[model samples]
Target: MNILVTGGAGFIGSHLCDLLLLQGHSITVVDNLLLGRKENISHLLNRDDFSFMKEDLLNLPVLKHIFENGRFDMVYHLAANSDIQKGSKDPGVDYDLTFNTTFNVLQCMKEYDVKKLFFASTSAIYGETCDRLTENYGPLRPVSNYGAGKLASEAFISAFSSAYHIQTWIARFPNVVGERFTHGVIYDFIHKLQANPEILTVLGNGEQIKPYLYVKDLVEGIQFICEKACERFNVYNLGSDSRTKVKEIAAMIIEEMGLDARIEYTGGDRGWVGDVPEFKYDLSKINELGWCAKHDSNASVRLAIQKALGK
Candidate 1:
């Protein structure tokens, strides 16, 4: 299958591209290089089954041209402003980069007669929920611009799928960590400790517990869901079965790096204004489909740290 992956040069997206290429799919990557590094996809530059386009999806004309010429059978939409911490600082970033780009992608899909879309939705859309979030969980309140944009993009994808007979898969992912990770707690902690080994500045109270999934696990989970749950519109919560606290992650990083840094907290449940301190997803839906996450949250964190430290 010839497929297109937007933001395919980023952390999870690059991993997805690697998996798809291994599965004998012709993969074309479209990335703006704003947050996605070229080196992430540099290894695939010579493959006959792989191609990379240094273009932004926000440019509708360029996107349309690519779609018309490339004739992609399916699209994996992962392009968006992923920096949740700074989402509040610039409101327009999510609008222009995330939601607007989604709208354009759907439009191009419709215009090009493409019938399939795989959207990369986030767990942030649940918005500080006390209950274990399910795919059906609603009120769908997103506290940050980043989450709001993802939720909005999900809505557009759903509407487009139904209206145009496009098959769609929407997977809400937890904090994904593994190789080629550009940002996240693990990445930040590694960089911070490298600079100042004596003290590690922990965000929030270090009590913020959330589920983490290894990138390889996430890619496989997505593949499993896409293969098993074929529907006009599908939604699933893709995450690990258990949760891990922020302090645990920091400790793992510090221990792995052989550093004795004092963990310092800024004191808050939420790390930033829009940060959701703790949340878990009921993976029963995907689990029932014969897909279970292999790594628990702690193991995922440890593996991510090892990969980030190049071990």
Candidate 2:
């Protein structure tokens, strides 16, 4: 099967591309290299079965041209704005990169008669919820622009799947961490420590808890669900069974980097305005399908830290 991964040069997408290639599938990666780094997929650049196109997804004409010719069997829409905080400052950031990216991809896919699509969604769409979120969690009121944009994309994906007969898989994800990571808590923590080894400033109350999953686990879960879940439009939550705190992650990073830095608190519950300080996942849906994350939240954080530190 021929596959098209939208953000194939990013951390998670690159890993997915690697697995797809190993499984004897031809992979075509289209990443504008905004949130995605070219180095992540550099090793596969020379492969005959793997092709990388440095093009933005917003360009409908170019996207149409590519889709008309490549003849993709499936599309993993992994492209999105990585920085959630940016959306709080400028709403257009998420509108252009997050929502618009998915919108254009669907249009081209519909035009080209692409049958299957796998959308990369986030836990942020659930908003500030106290309950462990399921895929069917009601009245999704996303606080962050990133979440809102993702929700909008999901809506369109569903609409397109129903109208055009496209088989769609939407996986709401947790804090995905691993090698070649460019954004999120672990990446930010390491970069901060590198800049100033003496003092580490943590935002929020340092008690913000959320699930963290290894990128490998996330990719594997998606693969399993795709093979097993048969529906016109499938939505599932992909995450670790457990959860982790902000301060816990800071401590992990400090220990991994061997830093003797003082931890300072910014005195708030959320790291940012739209930040959901606490959220959990009920993985019963995917677990019922006989798939569970191998690494717990703590293990995932530890592994991501080690990889980030090059240890």
Candidate 3:
């Protein structure tokens, strides 16, 4: 199969590309290097089966040109603004990079007669819900521009699927961590400690708990759901079974880095605006499909720290 992955040079997407190539599929990666680093997919540039395009998904004409030449069978949409606060600062970023990218991708796919797509969705679409979030659980209100944009993308995906017979797999992921991480709590903590090892300042009150899924585990879920779940539209919550607190993550990072830093709280329920301080994913749907995350949140945190620290 020939696969086209938007944002395939980024953290999770690059991992997806690796798995695809290992499975004997030829892949063409289109990434503008916004959140994606060239280094992430640099290792694949030399291969015959792998190709990388330094292009933005928001540019529809160029995307269309690529689609015409590629003859792609499957499309994986992962391009989006990774930062909530950054998008909150400028809603246009989320609009162009997150939502518009999906819209444009769907348009190109429709024009090119591509039938299958895999979307990298997020749990943030659930908002600050108290209940364990299921694929069917919704009032689907996202507080942040980032989540709002992704939710909007999912809506278009559903529309495109129904209006045109496109098969789609949507995985709502938790906070993913591991190697090649561009930004997130663990990455931020590592950089902060490197700057000042004496004091590690935490964003919120340190009680925010959310599941952390390893990136590898996530891509495996993608592969599993991609192969097994046959439907016009399939959605699943891909995450760890257990939850870990932010303070606990901080403590683990502190211990792993051998830092004597004092953990300081900024005193808030969440790290920033548009942040969901607490949430849980009900993986019952995927579990019933015979797919589950091997690492719990705590183990994911520690393993991610080790990979980040290169220990």
Candidate 4:
């Protein structure tokens, strides 16, 4: 199969590309390199089954050209403004980057007669719900613009699927952590502690907990769903079964890095203004589909810390 991965140079996207390539599939990567690093996909440049284009999906002309030339069988749309904290600051940017680009991708798919689309959605769309989040969660009340954009994109994809007969799969991921991670709690802690090993300043109180999934496990789950699932519009929560606190993550990083860092709380309810304080995912659907996450949140944090520290 010939696959096109948008944002294929990013942390998750690159890992997806690696897995796809290993499966003997030809892949064309489309990345703007705004947040994605070239080095992430550089290792695959020489391979005969891999190709890359350094352009954003927001640019219609470039996207059209890629679509016309590549003629992809399946598209994995992982490109978007994924930062919740940053999205809270400038929502307009998030809307443009996510909704607009997704619209363009759907347009290209419609025109080119593409078969399937795999969208990367998020748990942020659920907001602050008390119950464990399921695929059929009621009324998406996204606190941040990032979640709103993802939900909006999902709606567009659903509409496209209904009108144009495009098969789609949506994966709502939790906090993804692993190797080559550019940003997030683990990366932030590593950088902060590296700068000042004596003291680690946490963003909020230690009580906040959320599910975390290793990148390897995430990629495997995606592969399983794409291959085994037959639903026209399927939504699954890709997250670890366990949850870990932010302070616990910091402590794990400090211990893993062998640093004598003192944890300092900033005294806040959430990590950021629009951050989701706590949430749990009911992964019964994915688990029923015979895909289970191997690493828990704490284990993922420790391993990610080791990978980030080059240990």
Count clashes in each candidate, considering only residues at least 3 apart in sequence or on different chains: 0, 0, 0, 0
**In model 3, which range of ten residues has the least summed lDDT?**
52-61
lDDT leader: 3
Candidate 2 C-alpha lDDT tens digits along 1-311: 99999999998999999888888999999999988999998899999999999999999999999999899999999999978988889999999999999999999998889999999999989999899898899899999999999999999998999999999888999999999888888888889999999888999889999999999999988888788999999999999888999999999999888888899999989899799989999999999999999999999999999988888
Compose the digit string of candidate 3's lDDT tens values, residues 87-149: 999999999999999999999999999999999999988888889899999799999999999
Candidate 1: the clashing residue pairs are: none
C-alpha lDDT score of every prediction, in listed order: 0.92, 0.92, 0.94, 0.90
Q: Which stretches of candidate 2 lie over 4 Å from their true place?
A: none
**Per-model TM-score versus the true fold:** 0.98, 0.98, 0.99, 0.98
The residue-by-residue lDDT of candidate 4 on 28-84, one tens digit each, is 999898879999998999999999989989999889889999989999999998777
Candidate 4 off by > 4 Å? none
Question: By the lDDT metric, which is better: model 1 or model 4?
Answer: 1
Candidates 2 and 4 compared: the better one by lDDT is 2
RMSD value for candidate 3: 0.6
Worst 10 residues of 2 by lDDT: 218-227
